[model samples]
Target: MSQADKLRQLLAQDKLHVMPCCFDALSAKLIEQAGFDLTFMSGFATSASRIGAPDLGLMSYGEVLDQARNIVEGTSIPLIADGDTGYGNAMNVKRTVAGFAKAGAACVMIEDQLAPKRCGHTPGKAVVSRDEAFDRIRAAVDAREEGADILIMARTDARHDHGLGEAIERAARFKELGADILFVEAPKTREEMIQICRELPGPKMANIVEGGETPELSHQELHNIGYAIAAYPLTLLAAAMKAMCDALAALKDDEPRTHLLSNFGELREKIGFETYYAASERYSTSRRY
Candidate 1:
């Protein structure tokens, strides 16, 4: 089946499908090899990794699209990218939606945070006016061409700014505007989480356990709720950071991997650089033959 059909099938199932967010080709390849059916091109991950900047809407559409294209090329799994406030208002959303779709993103999520927005999980988030956000959603839905299963996910940062009830109401409205998926970003407590699931229904998604601020639940538990999609957006990146810190500390002490023989070969095997080089050499040799 096509990726679109595969995604739709996964959505139709009774439980939430997990989409781990990937920062680069290495992460994407790892997720693919681990048998994840879907992944997200995280704007926050890309911005922080590439430039050491926060996801304060500092990254441009061009920058995001470039990263997204690389991630898509790296894996065959369906990719839902962070389009980041559509890089502007409604018109900009149209362009961004179309451009990202063409760039091989199976889907792109545009949040309702205003331009120059902070990260969704960050404190002090301010959202756009309801009408303004709705207009952006409409433009995003309208922008995609035929034969493009490029889904548009309308994410609301209003859970923090406007309260859960208002966020649910806004999500219902976005559903009416034909958002393929709805992300009510960052509900803090388990009660808040359950309430959002109950209140908002219809092709829904939740950013699972972002930054450990919101209540963390098992995948099975989240799927038991009505959430059709769940993303662990930064877990891999966090683990990677932790490992890097430990490794560096070990280096500083002149004890880097000294006793850590477990999977030393597996570490290089996970990167698979030599395998890629071998494949490239075979192709080059074939051309000469």
Candidate 2:
């Protein structure tokens, strides 16, 4: 089955699907090896990894697509990618959806934030007009109908700028526009999270960002609140960052931080070094010419 179909099947199951955010192919492989059935190519993480920049709409469509392609190639799990603001207007959203789907994304999340969009948890984020936001989602739905089975996840940042009511309304409209999933980003309180799942129609996704504006709820807690999918967008990134920092500090003191790192051999195996060598050996000896 196609990756998109696999994701759809997973969503159809009567349980919450947990997707950890992977910033690159290595991270993607790690997520898969760690037993996750699905992964998310986080825009915020990608910007940080690729350009060492914040998620202030700095990464372009091409950049994100390339990263998505790398992650998709590195793992067998279905991947959901963050398509921030679809990178432009409605037409741009169509192209963005097509590009990401072609790059092997099972689902693409397009938010309603305006141009130069900031991270959902960041302050000073503004959303487009209701009509424009709806147009973007309609465009994404149209793109999906044009032969891409990629699921369309509609995200609304209106919760921070406007209010929970507005965010819920936007998510409802997005659902009407054929969004496969709804994401109301940055709901500060548990009550707001519950209300979002209760009020929003169809399948819902919750983004749990550590230390962000939204409360970090466990998978079971979110599932009980009616969330279909829960994404920990920066979990790996945050952990990796701290590990790298401490390792660097230890290195400066001439103290090998062996305990702070994964075994090199195991890390190579996790990244498919053994499989690669075996494939090379098989192909090298089986050549007919």
Candidate 3:
């Protein structure tokens, strides 16, 4: 099945999908190895890993699309891309959605946050006006309708500035605008989360940013709260960072950090050396380049 079709099938199931977001091709491959049916290309993690920068709309459309293309090429599972603010106005939103679809994203998430938008849990985040917000999603839906062959996930960061009520209102309108999925970012409490789900329709996504505004609820708790997808955007990135730091600290103290790594064979396998060698065997001998 097509990636978008697969995403639709998964979302149709009445279950809470625990998705671990990925930064790069290797991370995406590892997520598939761990048996996840879906994932997201987290802008925050990709910005940190690729450019050593924060996700304050610093990465351009080309950069994010290139990263997403690499990830999608390396994995079979469907990936939802983070298309922050659609990178410009309504026309830009359409182009961003279509580009990501062509890049093999199962879905492209278009948010209503203003230009140079910061992370959802970060300070100083603001969304555009209501008409502009709806226009963004409308453009995205238009892109999909014009043969993009991808889902449009509408996101609203309005909870930070306006209130939970405003966030839900935007998400509801997004659903009406033909968003396949809805995300209302940074709801503060469980009660607020529950209320957001209670009011918003369609398959809703709950972002679980550890130590951020939203409470890190368990998958069952989120499922009970009516969340269709629970996205752990930074967990893998943060854990990888912690491991690197510990290994560096051990090296500074002249201690072996072997325990922090997978063994040589397993590492080679994870890196696809074995698979590469096996495939190379198809060639009986060396051929001229």
Task: Candidate 2: list runs displaced more than 4 Å.
Answer: 285-289
RMSD value for candidate 2: 2.1
* lDDT scores of the candidates, listed in order: 0.81, 0.90, 0.93
Off by over 4 Å in 1: 145-148, 258-268, 273-289
Question: What is candidate 3's CA lDDT for residue 189?
Answer: 92
Which candidate leads the pack in lDDT? 3
The model with the greater lDDT, 1 or 3, is: 3
Residue 4 shift from truth in candidate 2, angstroms? 0.8
The order by descending lDDT is 3, 2, 1
Q: Candidate 3 on 1-289: residue-level lDDT in tens?
A: 8899999999999999999999999999999999998999999999999999999999999999999999999999999999999988999999999999999999999999999989999999989999999999999999999999999999999988899888889999999989999999998899999998888888999999999999999999999999999999999999999999999999999998899888999989998988887887778773222
Better candidate number, 2 or 3, judged by TM-score: 3
Per-prediction count of colliding residue pairs?
A: 0, 0, 0
Q: Against the true structure, what is every candidate's RMSD?
A: 2.6, 2.1, 1.7
* lDDT score for residue 64 of model 1: 86
In order of TM-score, best first, we have: 3, 2, 1
Q: Clashing pairs in model 2?
A: none
Return the TM-score for each candidate structure: 0.90, 0.96, 0.97
